[model samples]
Target: MNSAVFYSSKTDMWATPQDFFDALDAEFHFTLDACAVKENAKCEAYYTPEQDGLDQPWTGRVWCNPPYGRNVGQWVKKAHDTASGGGFVVMLLPARTDTRWFHDYIYGKTEVRFIKGRLKFGSCQNAAPFPSMVVIFGGEHKNE
Candidate 1:
């Protein structure tokens, strides 16, 4: 297999697995999908690529499955910053714990749950090449 394509896909975005998202939504009651397209959006309120979620202020409980690539660090930093400003953010990310973003934002800064095995994201017949993890910044949502 070509390692380049494996690490950096033609499309950085990966659709979040439904069953996984359903479980998290049940727990967090997410108010916004911080990064999503129209068809696969997990919430009624979402930010599309055109909307540039990074430029917007995240509010309430947020769900983010950001595009995976070099820019992922920006997303992780945004999640941490949003939480620091009092918003709860949950992210579905590759379990690339050695990456700079993991050390910079996730290490000792958030709650992480590593998945047992690879995930079959979207309609892909095969499981993802990489492992996955759920990272939560801040606590459970409050009705504030």
Candidate 2:
């Protein structure tokens, strides 16, 4: 596998593994897919890229597997804001513990579950290059 494909792909979208999503859905009963395209949406009430989830209202058990790009900080901030307002949000994100977003938004504010092994995301033939973690913001299982 070319390391470049994993490091610098043209798009940042990485479809979440179905099994992983199912497990979380069973626990959270997610009401919306906060970030998805039509094809890979995990929930019936999903916001496509056109809807720009960053600008939308998240009012329930929301699942966010956002594009792991430059704007990921925005997504985390939104989740934090929504949770502060009593919404439940669960985010599947890279275990980038060193980043500014990790320290600023997730360090002490959310429940983070680091996966033991790399996940084979969607139909991709190889496992993801980076480790993953699930960050929960408000819910029965919230950090607080």
lDDT of each: 0.87, 0.87
Candidate 1 lDDT (Cα, whole model)? 0.87
| Model 2 per-residue lDDT at 83 | 93
Candidate 2 local accuracy as lDDT? 0.87
lDDT of 1 by residue, 1-144 (tens): 232332234677888889999988888889899998887789999999899999988997899999987899999999999998888999999999999999999999899999998988887677888999999999655443
TM of each candidate vs. truth: 0.90, 0.90
How does residue 12 of candidate 1 score in lDDT?
79
**Sequence-dependent TM-score of model 1:** 0.90
Error of 2 at 105 (Å): 0.8
> Which stretches in model 2 have alpha-carbon errors above 4 Å?
1-8, 142-144
TM-score of 2: 0.90
The weakest ten consecutive residues by lDDT in model 2 span: 1-10
Tens digits of lDDT, candidate 2, 1-144: 332343234568888889999999887889899998777889999998899999999977899999998999999999998998988899999999999999998999889999999988867877889899999998575322
